[model samples]
Target: MNASMLSYILLSCVLLSVQAHNCQVREIIRNTKSLLNKTEESWSCRETAATPCSCLPIPEPGHELACFVEGTNHMMEHNMTTDNRLFLLNQSFQIQLDRNLCESLTSGKECKYKTKGTVKTFLEKILKTYQEIHKSRV
Candidate 1:
């Protein structure tokens, strides 16, 4: 194949790869949302005794899964209420799995809500961190 043809093919492959990745993320968001909705009715009671936000770790860059797992484990280890579990799941969604903990996803806002503790006051700081990672933090 000619060099131009090869370049185009490579570009197409890259695009497809990215689309596939996005599709996977979207599917996860869909599934998590569904699961949460299924049990949402009882969430209010769970929130009545919400876990302290301090216990939630702000996942570092490239540590989305690790942080998520750790957070879940933390919750389970302490037998956290269902609301806290769902809260993490929802907040994790705003970032969609690739940002810092305190960062906001849609607004491009930085550290939008590192404080304040209440379920309703969230969106103001709902696991919104979605960083693009311009460079290494190290």
Candidate 2:
């Protein structure tokens, strides 16, 4: 499907998922911002892992992004094709073929590090996006 179509589907899932959990977008956005701040300060690229996609727990012993997902209690996991976390993960996993070569939690140090950079950049972007949205709401 085209990008617009895909986005519609993902948004649908997020809306449904939000209602199912009685979560407000405002709250999720607020929580996401808080988590992003902490992550940007400390996240790093691991040079090794016990296994691929291993759910070690936050302070998770693998890819930084995977650990972040775990902390979300899985809410950030699904219905979020639009969310940068999954999109970035999917794009990195599928598009960045070179990343598979590194000895990382699941990929390479460069890969994870690059992903961290992307996450940091996106964190800033999302923060700005939310700020704009928040301003519009007020």
Candidate 3:
């Protein structure tokens, strides 16, 4: 190929690589959001308030955007798709930890409590990581 043609080919390859990188970033955000939704769902599905809460996988900071978006999607599903009032309360309870603990104790036998505590800790760590990432980006 001529020099000009070779240069054009190299430029195209570079541009494509950059585009692929951007797409991967977007995918990571989407996955993070999905993880959030699953976390919410697992919280909602409780037979009783007890020890050793069900463990949900926490998404990493690298997938924060995706996880956040997924969480939002889960919220919309609960609020918009369902007529169940408990879902709303569950969402609120998930946000307020001490309150949730009280409510869980009042509602169910001793089971899955410890697991919930662990989940809370994991989430806090993930949030901190996400914050650091955002700070760096800014």
Tens digit of per-residue lDDT, candidate 3, span 48-133: 45632333334442333333333334544534224233243333323322233222112322122223223334445334543444
Task: Please list all clashing residue pairs in model 1, or write none if there are none.
Answer: 99-131, 103-128, 103-129
Off by over 4 Å in 2: 1-25, 40-117
The candidate that wins on lDDT is 1
Question: Which rank order by TM-score, best down to worst?
Answer: 1, 2, 3
lDDT of 2 by residue, 86-114 (tens): 44433332322233321233332221222
lDDT of 1 at 50: 50
TM-score of each: 0.32, 0.30, 0.26
Model 3's TM-score against the true structure: 0.26
Better of 1 and 3 by lDDT: 1
Clashes of each: 3, 0, 20
For model 3, the stretches where C-alpha displacement exceeds 4 angstroms are 1-57, 80-127
Off by over 4 Å in 1: 1-23, 31-54, 81-138
lDDT of each: 0.40, 0.40, 0.38
Residue 133 lDDT, candidate 3, scale 0-100: 40
As for TM-score, the candidate ahead, 1 or 3, is: 1
